[model samples]
Target: MSATGVVNVDDARVAYRLHGRGPAVVLVNGTGGGDGHWGDLIERLARSRTVVTLDYSGAGETTDNGAPLDLPTLARQVAAVSEAVAAPHVDLVGHSLGAAIATVLAAERPELVRTLTLVAGFLTAAEPRLKLTFELWRRLIAVDREGFIQILALTTLSDKFFASPLAAHLDALAQGILTGTNWEGLARQVELDLRVDIHAEASRVRCPTLVVGCAHDQIVTRARDLCDRIPDATFSEIDAGHQAYFEASEEFAAKFLTFADGLYSPRRLSSSVS
Candidate 1:
């Protein structure tokens, strides 16, 4: 079964979609992403589980008064959607910014999450490199939107991707990114990204968790740091960049499904991309 709806969260109208059936698996998107971004992964997971996706306050079909984005509020929005689903508990899969939100949720509301999977996640953006990158993003968005997207692509995608035949369609890819992006929303998310700090929450996460890192990721290089903070959390690395889910979808899905199904051993500290 498939359905779509919105959940009221403070001043925001958060949109969400449901696909397939069985155990619930909620997928949370990163900065500038929405429920729509999980199309491919949803297709793979939905075959065996009810896949849920939602747009944060500034992304996708979600809307809110122009309040500056914050981690607590964003996490609340995710919690609202999870509660709306009425599931006893759901497997939570979060990427990048979504991972931080998931960390907060898992800490504050452990009963809502059965298992947690954080991909390309980080403990905080207070690190010099991350802070500078996000600051640059804010400035670029204000002065040069096109350049901002171009730079984003360069940093998030691996060199291997650019060397592949798919590079011939770079123009189309950029155009799609340009058209699909919500500039104002993205700017707000970028602002939130700059302020993200979830170390305390990560340590409080008691649920089984998996932290997936991108070997070539230029963004969120501290994914393993997050894993170290969480008790018994397993760490895995994919041979791609920040956008590993897109660059290596099959491998990403396989790892995620294995963890979500409880087949993966938390004792295993690390796993390489197969």
Candidate 2:
């Protein structure tokens, strides 16, 4: 069984759902991602733990005033949902943009986050390649929506995935992206993506951290650099593209479960959560 609710944070109505029961684990989505992106991973995790998933202001069932998005505000929204769920501490698993948000939350309120996992995360977007990519994404959405979705699919998914049988569903995938997208919200998120810099916050995160990098990720290539910045953060790699969690769900879930369960030893242990 599962329960759902909404948390009013600032000008946004953050929608969240809770599944299964055990130690709490919050899954934070990346740019343009929502509850649906979790797919089978949610079911796998929910079998032995409480999984929390939510939509940011620009995605899914969540709604917010037409204002620009910022990291602190997004992190606060996640914090609000965490508080609403009545969990004393949670294991946060964030992807791409969500990883930066999770880092901010863990740094600001270390007591609320028991562990942190960053998948395909980057420290900053000021790099020329990333900045240009997001700028192009914003512009493409305005003049060519279909082109935008097609380009997104090409960049986020691995070539290996396309060669697989799943390639037959490309049309369905594109249609889903078109209907589910909130253009205005996504544009704001893209703007946020271009300006996000969590260098300061990454150093302040005081939880057992795992940074997972994707080998063929074209979107964010600084996952290794991010892992190096955090004190004693464990680093791992997946053989997939930007959407490693979705591309290699089983492997990602196994590594996540091991880390969250405190069964894996860290390369270097700087601090411990009590």
List the candidate 1 regions with Cα displacement exceeding 4 Å: 263-274
Q: Model 1, 30-142: lDDT tens per residue?
A: 99886545537788888888989999987888989988999889889999999899898888999999999999999999999988999999888998889998999999989
Stretches of candidate 2 exceeding 4 Å from the true structure: 263-274
Candidate 1: Cα lDDT at 147: 94
lDDT of 2 by residue, 105-180 (tens): 9999999998999999999999787888899898998899899988888888899989988789889988998988
Residue 236, model 2: lDDT of: 94
Instruction: Give the worst 10-residue stretch by lDDT in candidate 2.
Output: 265-274
Q: Clashing residue pairs in candidate 2, if any?
A: none
Cα displacement (Å) at residue 246, model 1: 1.2
Q: lDDT: which candidate is best? A: 2
